[model samples]
Target: MKLQSTPPIPASDRQSPPAVLTLGPASCDAAILAQLLPVAERFRLNSAHLDPGGLVGWLDRLEALFEAEGRSVPVVVDLQGAKMRIGRFPSIPRLPGRVELVPGDRSERADTIPVPHPGLFRHAAPGDRLFLNDARVELEIERVGDERIGARTVRNGPLEASKGINRAPHPLPFEALSDRDASMIDASIGRPFVEYALSFVRSAQDAGLLRPRLGGHRLIAKLERTEAIAHVREIDAAFDESWLCRGDLGAQAGVGELGPIQRRIATLIPSLRNPCYLAGQVLEHMTHFPEPTRSEVVHLYEVARSGFAGVVLSDETAIGRHVAEVAGFLARAAPEE
Candidate 1:
């Protein structure tokens, strides 16, 4: 599909702390992608959402589109590494009540949420806290049974299927590289523009283990686990870059603590060797509105001041209502450049 030809982005309009655009289902639409791609400094694709073949096809299209533009943007194939997600279940209108947790990808019952990852069951215990759907819903474990675990929602909210699950303070007993991640990385070989971003990274060793598989492609360590923050220096050294994914980080740490955690990491960026980018929920309100909340704009400038090399827009650019407007806002807010 030919992208409608457009003028090149002006140097001044390019964000100072560059903006990385994350691709989602909505981004697959040609019209939507045409509106979003030019302003992006880099592209991020979640591996879980696309199979190897489909991903290559998407990459081909992206390359073609960029070829038309006379420039290319690096693509980051985001690996799901060690992240635990609940499987498919009908959306619950109201949460905060007791729910059952079982292991599988599909749950037929409304009260049951499929965890699908055995590591969670093996490590979870009574009284442990579980955060789901980015901590909009919080669960307190009531019992850990042989086949199913029981949890009561301490915080009330709606629940959705296939959302991320985080058990913080207690490390999830999963390795950094999942089988799917390994396969996807292997499939991505020989693609010069393709790089890998490892998710849920907890230690430098996790980054170390995945390094050999990339054949020296640049790796970006996503620091979401609270455990990772303590070892940020070592982890930073292991990767070409690091992403401070505030969404899961906030979910793991208390949401109320995200600001403090982000600021603390900001102070450490100057000491780190690799570039660190602020990610997750930047200009989130733009997902539904044409303009971002004033506070969100202020936060972008604050991140720039904190020495973040860039900011990643997830839902904002992926499924947002005003994609071009969102990108323009980020560019206009660029720090003195």
Candidate 2:
């Protein structure tokens, strides 16, 4: 596919768009983070993957690292709330022919699987569908018992075990922020220049629930689900900023549908005069190679022409081998403002 041509970058404004870089378990080393910071204008620490204690330690280390550099950077904490995920595995398991997800069963297996999150059973019901591994696999809940759920795979694929799960149909009647997320929000209340990204936001009410608890920090909503897309007008009316989570949205609606949705959102969310970030796989190939693929370069160019506020790096910078090089590539390729 031909990428939309990117506008020329002016000589005066050579810097890239405001990019947000994720720093997590994979890229938590001090030296690596220090090297990445100069290229990254913002740092995002995922609270979903880290426990409260781990989150605290990460915040402390990042703060110390920034202090040593004599630079203050924007820090964003992403909360993993009611989003469903597969139980942890010792490693990323190879795809199985078929996997059955039964609640409370924690044993690793080829056909039958366990869901460790007790909350899934508590919140989800029979007839509701579960999206796993970025929605590559689909399962329909046939029955729900006290602690176990009986689900059959409707759609199956080669899943890299332990990836996050999303619910299909509509929003579940659960809190947007988990107890652990609330604590992180509480602790980060007074910190200067910190931003909170609420993931899987389905409605304006979800954003409203966060306002009281979050003491002066900026709130950025991550619109990653079908429900959020349906309610984009309401959500846009509520939150000042939002992220177009192409990866998650692609899971809900096929990747082919992402472009129009992104463009519609950019037009709808005016408060977010800031560019909406095109996330997930922006430079996925760079995880293995030192250089980005031509297709990835075209994708980046398309993102630039789309006029987003910024492009975010996930595995590309957080765990990839060529973190700085990828950042430099993006900086060089971004359309000049």
- Best-matching candidate per TM-score: 1
In terms of lDDT, the best-performing candidate is 1
* Cand. 1 TM to true fold: 0.90
Residues 1-337 of candidate 1: C-alpha lDDT, one tens digit per residue: 9899899766644335688898877577776666666678898888766778878888888888787767788999988888877888788777637888998989878778898888888889999999888888889999998979999988877777777888866658446567777778877777899988888888888877887788889999998988888999999888899999989988888778888888888899899999999988888889998898878777776777678998888888766777778767765655454
Clashing pairs in 1: none
Tens-digit lDDT track of model 2 for 101-198: 66642455656666766667677888887777777677788877777667777877656445777666563444655677788887676668688888
Off by over 4 Å in 1: 1-16, 334-337
Model 1 root mean square deviation, Cα atoms: 7.0
Listed in order, each prediction's TM-score against the native is 0.90, 0.84
The root-mean-square deviation over C-alpha atoms between each candidate and the true structure, in angstroms, is 7.0, 4.6
